[model samples]
Target: MTCDEAQILLHALLDNELDAGHAREVEAHIASCPACAAELAAQREMKRVLADTKLSYSAPAGLRARIEASMPQARPQPSRRSVLRGFAMGSAVSALAASGVVAVVLRQDDQQRILSEVVSAHLRSLQAGHLIDVVSTDQHTVKPWFNGKLDVAPPVIDLTAQGFTLVGGRLDYVDARAIGAVVYKRRQHIINLFVSQTASTEHRPPKTQTMQGFNCRRWGERGLNFWAVSDIGGDELTEFVDKFEAAMKVNVEG
Candidate 1:
């Protein structure tokens, strides 16, 4: 893995959020790369200092009791019929929870968290030298750069003809694992197309979400999840994804 790839994962490694495979890879890279080794040491020192510091403010005594006193008095106990009704409602809720309704809710929350992380990754890529590990416009060169680095490399399409120029690719972490990011340029704007393997082989349609002033279009195809994030307008971003997807289909069928 390149330093650029290892740099982003250092934090995940520190937090023990990375899977075993990724943790070993980052650790191995840090061992041989002096620059990355120093970086890891500095991060560890910073974390240690922060942990020793007292940053949280302690609430004053009686705060909860005072707030409770200001509120209206509690209502009387429910009648026997009302108590039974509440019991029935609670049972129904438990049944729904067992039937995966709660899992659906949790999945939505996880999705939002991933989207936030994707935008953060995009912003981090905007920093100098943090963008691409392999700097090249050739789709053939960029695609193979991720061969053994990632479990599955992202599709590298030369979309220069479609207005989004293929620039390079890199390894980035999302959802606690290393994933592939294919970089593209839409004029001055940068697009980071992140790809990761998914357990399910379901093909999901693209959904556009705006976060932190950037537009993100995410979808799933052929058991892989993809997120394309950029500052470009929504319509143009959609056009980019559409064209990119079409090209991917052609490649698969051809």
Candidate 2:
């Protein structure tokens, strides 16, 4: 789930009012994301602070009922100040906590923040014309350049026969991990296939997501994650992903 959706449901989440599925997704995202987890921790602290306080207030039960019974059937709206003044200490604490949680959510959108960083790096590379640290169409040479630079060497393939030409390779950091960017070209469009090692509990079908105006298609294979991002059309990008996967499978099987 996105952070905005999580924020809207946070109060319900705190109250234990969210449905099971949504609660699970939000909790999983919160576990993966530190900023959101910190927000959760702050809210928990608020709850702790409120819970620890000794609040003593006993309203004469019948007195409020007796006053309401005597009032006319047609009620008048209370003044804004009166309403504000009428809130109890617990209500004030809740309001403050909700406001603080919303503020934190608005300030730190973890998912989009990471995506923006990835997209920015891509844009910056193109603008500065420094897309590749190692330049070679040959995957052997291009892949070996990563030695002593990064922990893992990303699989580099030449997709020229499939109309996606291998340009070269570059090193990039995205989603808090060091990754190898295998550059490809479709017509004049640039496709950056960022590869990194990430473990997943379950293997699922690849999915495409648009992030900050760039299309990113991500999938997992052989214990590594591949994220291909480009401004190229979705259909074409999907084709590229398909051929790339097929090529990898061939390389593995061969």
Candidate 3:
């Protein structure tokens, strides 16, 4: 992870809000980075000091009695039927709102979990001997490498004419399941395009996300989910995906 990305997540790590996967990723980065490690220590010290400091102020013992005494003597009460109707309406509204909130939270948690896994897999692939199980530039040669290796092999597109060269392919684990990673190279930057089969055949437009200084463009099409991750610029990454998708369409039609 980059220092900048680690900085943004340090507080979340300290607050214990990050999920186990992300927490471990951030902690691993900090272990190797002295600057981030020092910053985390400082954050821990500050939190400890704040916990020890007492900032609450108590009101006078009779403050509640005085406030009650100053209230109007007479007040009107709603009818029992009206009160019951209002309570029922409020209960329904609260239930709807709570359900909506829970749905949103669950979606966010799932997204974060997947993203953390993708980033970790990408990092692991960078290590020597972990990159490609099959190394070849020809799409024909690379595409057949995954025969029987996975339920569905990812499309290996030869984008060398478009500036992104086909490096090879690899098998990686994401979200606890094996997936195909079609590796590509943009100049010196490596892009790992992770593909996994999805139940949905619906199409999802590419959405860009950044994690630990790497740009990831993810989308779904033709019952497969794609995550293209690299250190390249966002625009370039988008262009890569666009060209890739276009090429895939051409191959499918031709």
Candidate 4:
């Protein structure tokens, strides 16, 4: 594969989406070309970093119910004849409806872009020399430290036995509200988990998402919304979430 072609397929190569033949060609090119090799190395490192960091966030409990209530009711399927007539007429109403949907979708995309940016900034901060504005392992100390800094108290759980120690936390402004950034450590890796009390709006469930070398998982429960981001491996990160959730469940029950 030429350098240009390899560059075009870089993301797909990282995602393991390329066909076997294409994958082989890209790999061969990467091995022979120093620049491509460096790029591949960087991508691999980003994946590792995302998998190694330990961050977690919880979505509010009411968010799901509210989302269900707010969802627009499905319109009755149009009759074949009605559909044909509308197509023939190039209906103004249909055009307007389509435009409105596009507008809403664009707006939502913009919001998501902003959220990603905020998350990226927070991630960069952790890598910098100063990670925490308030450093404490005690949940009591960490929770209350945000009393005046944020409007809501973020849950601070210590998972030292699970190989993730509570490093500390800081307050961040995101989605037009003050959110909490809880720091944790897994060996030398740092995980930054953001938490906030969302209103009655259900976001996408907690699933692993990768953005610019970071892995993020978002979920909601008990009126709390959680978003965990790290540069940790997918398997290990999922394991961390499983253990963290189990511990949180036990704590809640108690």
Candidate 5:
């Protein structure tokens, strides 16, 4: 395959989303083509860095309760009609109520979809044969790779001394913009740190939330918004964040 063709299919190839025939073709091309092989190697490294970074935070105790409370409640149906004519009308009303409930439920489900996607993407990255798209611990190398492909520069920080080693960074399309995902590793856990430059009004303080056993923490400061996710326990994740924040502060001050 041509270099351009290989480049176009590289992500899908790495994702193993291509059909057997296509996968074979791509593999053969990479075997003989130095350029394609280098591209594949870069993608593989990115996945490795992401897999090694272990970070996570716990959801506050009332998170689920709050979400449940905020959801709209279904109103009770009217009393059963005495006559056949009234009964038909009552049935229609009941149907409408049921539909309304379904709609509300779907809306709530949509609200949680983003969180689910974030976690699922991380998990998918960990699955066998899936990992980094570009692997490098150097911010200069990783950050430049995203130029022209994304609108903003994701701040890359190395936190190795603090126990969380910077594996690398990548550009991810999430919440409507190309955001930054800085990969880090803590022992056996892999942490994904997402960053974006949002408006001040859009900024939110660091808060932890959990979904499907994974932990997520988000906060905004100094013109950037950040989200960190992992399967690690709350205490350890929090400690990582504290250290990360301290590192950020030092960088900013310097």
Candidate 6:
């Protein structure tokens, strides 16, 4: 499913209006596209915001009783003016709720899709026996390799002092955009730190997620998005994120 097609039917997918097979394919495409995932999140947030908004209008005491008493079962119901006013109010509320549902359904993919891509990339690299392009332990050597390949060179760090050794690096893709993946090792486990240049300038701490038994943590800063994926423990993976972010700061200053 292309991005445009998936986007067009996002509302249907969100509302369970699509068949299972088609929904799966659309979800698969979204899983590999970061832009779609973020868009999906925004749509969900809009739905939640609408849901949280409370609209209350209280009628005077005995209002219901008065209406019931004034009604004539055999004759015509309440005055046309009153009936029309009630119908109008009911239709307005229904319309607002329906619009909220539509807004929330727009672009219905979420962050889980991005996490799936991260895990898939890591597993594909290991299973296909094609991992790194530049095999080197020196940060200086590995960092320079991306100079001509990408618009910005990802800062490579030698975290040997922290027990994560720099192994190599490679070019990868996410959401149709080329990105850099720096390889690392902790004991026998391999860590693939995926970095992509984005318009996002979020400096918030990373969030950890387990995708297919692998623990991954991702965060963003100064238009750069990073994702570290491996089978390593969540605690250890978090430490890795902290060290990497600190190294990023040092590299920026230097």
lDDT per residue (tens digit) for residues 1-254 in model 2: 77777766666788899899978888988888787788888887898898899786655534543454465522122233433443443464334323333233354576445554555556546655889888888888888887655555688888999999998998775644456788999999999888766566355567887654568787887777777888898888899999998998899799
The local distance difference test score of each candidate is: 0.79, 0.71, 0.80, 0.67, 0.66, 0.73
Q: Where in model 2 is the C-alpha error above 4 Å?
A: 1-111
- Assess every candidate by TM-score: 0.57, 0.55, 0.57, 0.53, 0.53, 0.56
Q: Write the per-residue lDDT of candidate 5 for residues 1-254, one digit (tens) a residue.
A: 89889987878988879999999998899899998899899998998888788756555524533443355522122222322333355664334333333333344464355554455455445553345556887767777775544445666777787788877765554543455678888998899887766667454557787754668787787677777888789888788788888777788798
Alpha carbon lDDT of residue 5, candidate 6? 91
What's model 4's overall lDDT? 0.67
Model 4 lowest lDDT segment of ten: 96-105
Candidate 4 Cα misplacement greater than 4 A, ranges: 1-111, 201-204
Model 1 residue pairs with clashes:
none
**Number of the top-ranking candidate, with lDDT as the measure:** 3
Better of 2 and 4 by TM-score: 2
lDDT over C-alpha atoms for residue 73 of model 4: 27
Per-residue lDDT over 1-254 for candidate 1, one digit per residue giving the tens place of the 0 to 100 score? 99999999999999999999999999999999999999999999999999999999755423533443455533222243543454566664333223432233354577876876676577667754689999999999999887767667578899999999999998775655667899999999899999988888888999998765678999999988999999899999999999999999999999
User: How good is model 4 by TM-score?
Assistant: 0.53
lDDT tens digits, residue span 154-222, model 4:
778888888889989976545444567888888877777788776755544568766545576767766
Alpha carbon deviation, residue 161, candidate 1 (Å): 0.8
Off by over 4 Å in 3: 1-108
In angstroms, how far off is 167's CA in candidate 4?
0.6
Measured on C-alpha atoms, candidate 1 has an lDDT of 0.79
Sorted by lDDT (best first), the order is 3, 1, 6, 2, 4, 5
